[model samples]
Structure formats: structure tokens, C-alpha cells
Target chain A: MCAELIFYSVVPSEEPGERAEIETFLLRNGLSYDEGIEIFVVGREGRKLVACGGLEQNIVKCVATDPLYRGEHLSLTIVDKVIHLAYERGHSHLFLYTRPNNIAFFAGCGFYPIVEVPGLVTLLENSPIGIRRYCDGLSKSRQPGARIGAAVLNANPFTRGHRYLIEKAAESCDWLHVFVVAEDASLFPYCDRFQLMKSGIEGIARVTLHPGSQYMISRATFSCYFFKEKNVAGDCFTAVDLLVFRQWIAPALGITHRFVGTEPFCRTTGKYNEDMKYWLQADLSAAKPVTVVEIPRIESHDRAISASEVRRLLGTNDFDRIAELVPQTTYDLLSSKYRMKAVGSHTSATA
Target chain B: MKIIKDAMAGTLESSDVLVKVSPSDGPLEVVVKSEVERQFGEQIRRVVADTLARLTINEGVVIVEDKGALDCTIRARLQAAVLRGGAVEGLDWSILQ
Candidate 1:
């Protein structure tokens, strides 16, 4: 017999009760909300959310259905809505992660299996021109020895600390792939940030700049840094994102080491890097084996030179103080004819 | 005002209300179904009835299936539905009302 179901999209910021319902259901089912991503849920007339999913960029994640609502075809129903929503938003490609046992279920929903980790996680895509395009772009300029290093940087305005991390990583690896966070949610637009990254690494002979694809700047990772109040997204949040990168992106590019700058003040980032440390060490997959290298932040005037501090100084119109924290390239951008109008939405004092 | 065609506005999603109006000659029939009926049923009915009264709509069958929408969302959606139902042109969506 078929059961009637109620389905709807929710703006968590607008509807607290419905958001709580979905959150409680997800927690009971052993899933966490990837903050900053859009979420949709199916509920009963009484307002108890039973099935739910989130969309971050082109990925559909955190999909969960309450046990009581099983056999109702709720998973596919939620997936279909998200797929239509993605198409409406102009996303031609979509990806999702689920336990290894459910590969056939998603394949039936038109997803092609990409990678299956030994333990329980699997990645699948719904596009015909699937992951090969991404793999080819990742290894665009392959170098020898296979000891490639990877770093995902927003580099809102690349600082000396950023330069130090890349240079430190370059010292040990044959090639370094620096992925600038391409999510337009950043204070500095992607183009300006990409320009700053290029200029920051211009002198490094080994560093190559690439946009961290849709999978990188996930709501699962760094996008929701300041939205922790909406949900308590601990290390597991970043771990999910890093696991996807490790299982899907790193191996194809021959990247053996992932470099990150240590966070001293931001609790969210500090916990995120810590989670990356745990996952990389505990992940025993032959194809997913990776070493996470967290470099000590470069210090200036007894303080860590950081993008957040530069943003703070920019907001206060303290160009001289900002000049000291950033590299010559960023300083040039700040002072040039364009006269970088300070636009960061986030800031933290340097410690 | 009289409803002319079978019309609907708003999504079936939670926190929204879908109002379907069908043309009817029988005494104006209003049927209300709501998720939050225990606490907000009377309020929901009042909003729908008040909107119909403002439109002078007394000759149609109106069905409101509500899912805990706020007063304003219900108001906006019902207004949109009434305008769409009449097959008329003067949809005064100005918030003054």
C-alpha cells in the first residue's frame, strides 16, 4: 500500500521549527547537516520531518530518511526534487555520497559510480561527461616523482603566511597544486582572489594555480565557518569534505601530501585542520592514502600573518597595518589604481 | 468577485499554503485542511475568509490546505490565488491592504 507524504523546501534561516524537525531527524539517523548548503525535507502532516537532503554547489549530501518512514520511496523522492532544483539553478552536474551498500540504488537514479572506499563510503555522479573531465584538469601539468602537494586556499588577499605555506610545501614536493577556493561566497570575488594567488606564487617555479572545483569549497568544509551557531558542525564536517577530496581528487592527481596553515584563533578552522589530520591518518584505503601537513603559521611582529587580520585592518582603513601582513602582490593590489575596496564579511584579530 | 477556473498558488512544501479555488454556483463552500489546525486552524480560516470578504467573493468553492505558513505568506498566496482564479487583470498586490 502507498502512503501519502508531504514534501517541501525549507529556508532554515526562516523556519526554525521545520529546521529543528529536519535536524533532529538527521541526528537520530546518524547524519549531520552540511551548513551553508540549501536543504529540502519531506514531512508528515503533523510536521515531523522524515526524509531530508542538502545541496552544496553541485553535490547532494546529508541525505537521510527516518526508519519509521522506510519503504515509502522517500529517498528517491527527495533526490528527484534536489535534481530538479539543481537543474533549475543551472547546475548541469550533480554528485552524492552514500554507504557502499547503496550503490545500486543510486545507480538506478541515474548516478554513475566513481569511487568506492574500502570501509563504507562511495561517490557517484549523475552526469554523462562525468569525473574524467575533473581528473584531466587536476593533472593538467603532471610532474615527476609523484610526490605532489595540494593546498586549498581562499587567499582572500594572499598574505605572507600563505606564501610561506606554499613555499614550505614546494620545498619537499616535485610539484605543488594550489587550489584557490572558487566559491563566490568569499569577500574578495573569485577573479580578484585568483589574481592575488597567481601574483603570490609568481616567483615559485613549482607552484601551479587551479580553481578548487565545485567539490572543494563545500558547505561541508570552510564555507560555513561563521555559521556554527546555526548548527554545531564539529570536526566531522571538515572530515566529510576532506574524505571526498582524498577519495576522489587527490589520487588522480598523484597528490601524496595536503598542506594547510595552522589556525591559532579561529576555533572552526582549528578543528577543521585537526579533523583533516585524523581522517588522513585513519584512512587506510590504498587509493586514498594521504599525509596531511599542517605548517606553523608564518609570524610577523610576533603575530601570525593571516587573511582574517588583513580583512580586519581593511575594514578599519588601516592600510599601513594591512601592508605589513600581506605580500608585495596583495599590497600592490590594495594600493593600485583599483584601490581595493575592503569588502570582507568576516574578520578575526591576529593573535 | 467570482472565481472562474480551477486555480492554485503556493507549493505543497511545509511553511507554505496552497489555496485552490474552483468556480461554483452552490452556496460559497469553504473547506480548510491544515497541519497546525490544533493551534492555528481558526486563525487560518479567519485569514482565508477575511481575504474572500475583502474581494467580495461569495460565490465559489475555496479550498485551503495549509502547512504552518505565516500570516503574511498565507495572505500573499491567497491574494495571488484569488487574482489568478478570477481570470481578471486588476491584481492590486500593493501591501497597503
Candidate 2:
């Protein structure tokens, strides 16, 4: 039966019918087609789509095998093909999101469980000790303090509001660990955002700037953070991200508090802020709960200073207005780097 | 032979083993996940270590996912992965035995 099965790849954009076929196959298997998936490897036993798997960046999703083909091990063929595809694309470290019940199946394929949000979702990585290795590396930078504070920020261009949040968080705790979100999905790339953050938060005592990892607010942990649409499953991804932070990240550094700036403009961000409190503090069953601290957003002319507003100003080439919203370092970098490009194109600043 | 890049070989089918080799800054680390780990875990590790020793590869991460594959299959997969990983500067056809 296995020898008779044929496998093929499908690019969703190129083959809409085949993509819909895979999506329908996934739906029948209790899985939905993720919009983020780029390529899918489907196993067919004489025109019957018996098994299917997808690769979205480095993460594998929407893997399913027909119930009739249970003993044929068709899932392995799909996974093997998907993994080869990922390696060809230079993605060595791979992740998979599966149901809790399917952990053993993926584990058999050499993917170990990283984090699980109960029955909602389970994240698995190719390496068994990947999360352990990340946490171990983090332990080397572990600071000595009783009241260790932490904050995760994208800091797209590092506004004054971000500076204020860091300063306030640092003042409240003995030491502060500020992780700049490393995903390059924002208007500003990660290096620029990281540099802007480094310069913006300079001269602040007892503050350590750390680069974000997949265990942090990354695409693997929370895809919704990068997307504009409000997904119902966003809450689930948020929980998984927060859980990874609480279970592995905070424990590695002995962090006691998590800080964030108040979000008044974006409803999604504001809801995330509300969810943080529930996940980080109220829902702790055994581990020590990290206190969620929300500082009011810094205002400029009665308007809350946000990276989005700075971006909007940059689109319009309003350096004067952007200068008011962002710090000196951010303003300098933005104006110097984007001044020429902003003249002809404003689409890049739209985020 | 040094693993200069990431490479993979073999499949996840029955009686087969999938091997992935990547350059590592740390020491040579071989991770084996097999269905028969309890019975052949140590033997699998020994085969992987011996294979790396034969290739004179001292620094890399070798991951082997076995689906009831024989020792010869594991060796073949690891060799293919190492060769594909661009550790072919010094040809050692004799050591492949």
C-alpha cells in the first residue's frame, strides 16, 4: 500500500483548485488551512489525497492523514517531503503546531514538544533540547536581583513612549531585562529597531537589552502579532507565547514582573495587554506569577506617542511631527535613513 | 571533514532513517530518536559516533530519526548527509567503509 502512494508539491497561489482540495482534506481531518502556509506536500493514493502537510516559513502546519490509510505511514512521507523542502529553503530549525493528542506522532518523527496551551495547541521543534538550549543560553546572561523586571517590545522605531516604559520599569525593579522583538515584520527591520532601542535606552542604569528569540514573541509563538487582522485564534497564540515566556523565559532569569506600555490606539494591542494580566498573573497554578505592569503611554501634545503615529508622520515626510513622537536617537536614524526614500514612496511606512 | 552547512538525507518511511547534519560551534553532538531506543539506543549512538570518527568530523550536530532502520542504513544516511553538507574538501572514499 505504501509503495503505491505518490507524493507531489503544491504552491497554493499557483494551484487554487489543488489548494482548495488540500484545504478540504484538512477540514475533514479536523484541521483548517492556515493562510500563512506557503507550500504543501500532498500524498495521493491513486487520486485520493490520503496524506498532506504544509510548510509556512520554518514552521510545519496542517498535517493530516486519511483514517483509511492509518497503517500505511503516509504521514511520514508527507513530513519527510516537507522537511526536505524546508532544508532546501535553508530553514534548518523547524517547528510544528499540532494538537495535544498528536504529540506522540510528531515526536516519533524526531520533533519534541516545546510548549503546549492545554488542548488548544502544541508547539514542537525538530531538536529535542532546542528550548532547553535557548533557556540555557539565557541563563548565562541572568542578572542577580530579587525584583527582576522584564519587558518585550517591538520598538519599530523606538519612540519616546518605549523609552518611558523602560525607564519606569527599570526604576520599579532592581534590574530590568528588556527584550526587543526580533521579528522583522514591522516597518523597520529588526537590526534598525534593535539599534534604535539600544541608542534610545542608553544611559539608563540597571537595564539590559536582549535580542528576542523564537521562544519570545516570534512568528512561531504568535503569528497574529505580525498580522493586522483580528483572528479568533489570536487568543490561543497569545496564550502559547505568554506560556513560553512564563514557563521558560521568566524562570531562566528569575524575572518577577513583566512590563508594558498602555495601548490606547490599537484595539488588538490593548486586548493583548488585557490578556497579559490574565495569563501572567491570574492563571498561574504552580509557578510564581510574574506581575503585569502597565505604564501609561507618554503623550505629545495630548496625543499618545506611538510607533504607528511616528510611522504615519514618516509616510507624510513630517519629520517635525515624528521628532515629537520619537526619541532623539530614533528621530535621527529615521530621518537620515528614510528621508530620501520617503519622497517617492510612502507605502513602505504604512506597516 | 567539517560540516560547513546544513544538509539532510533519507526519508521517514518504514525501515528507513532520516539524518540531518549541520555545522555547530560546540562539540560533536549526535541526537538519535528511534522507535526501538530502549533496545538499541546505546548501539545506535555507538554507530553514529563511529561513523563520525571514521569521517574525522569533530564538530557538528548530527540528528538521526530512525524508523526501525538497520545499522547499515543509519551509516549510509549519515554519510550522504555529511557529503551533501559540503564536508567534501578532502576526499576519503576509503574511510566510508
Predicted structure with the largest DockQ when compared to the true one: 2
Candidate 2, A104-128: lDDT as tens digits = 8888777888877776667789888
CA error at residue A70 for candidate 1, angstroms? 3.9
Off by over 4 Å in 2: A1-3, A224-234, A283-285, A343-351
Error of 1 at A163 (Å): 1.9
DockQ, Cα level, model 1? 0.02
Q: Per-prediction TM-score, please?
A: 0.62, 0.92
Report residue B16 deviation for candidate 2 (angstroms). Answer: 1.9
> What is the lDDT, from 0 to 100, of the residue B82 in candidate 2?
91
Q: Roughly what TM-score does model 1 have, to 2 decimal places?
A: 0.62
Instruction: Give the chain B TM-score for each candidate.
Output: 0.90, 0.94
Tens-digit lDDT string for candidate 1 (B2-63)? 78875666654568776656676656778776768999999989988887888778887676
- Which candidate has the highest TM-score of all? 2
Q: Clashing residue pairs, candidate 2?
A: none
lDDT tens per residue, model 1, A197-235: 888887887888887666675532333332342343354
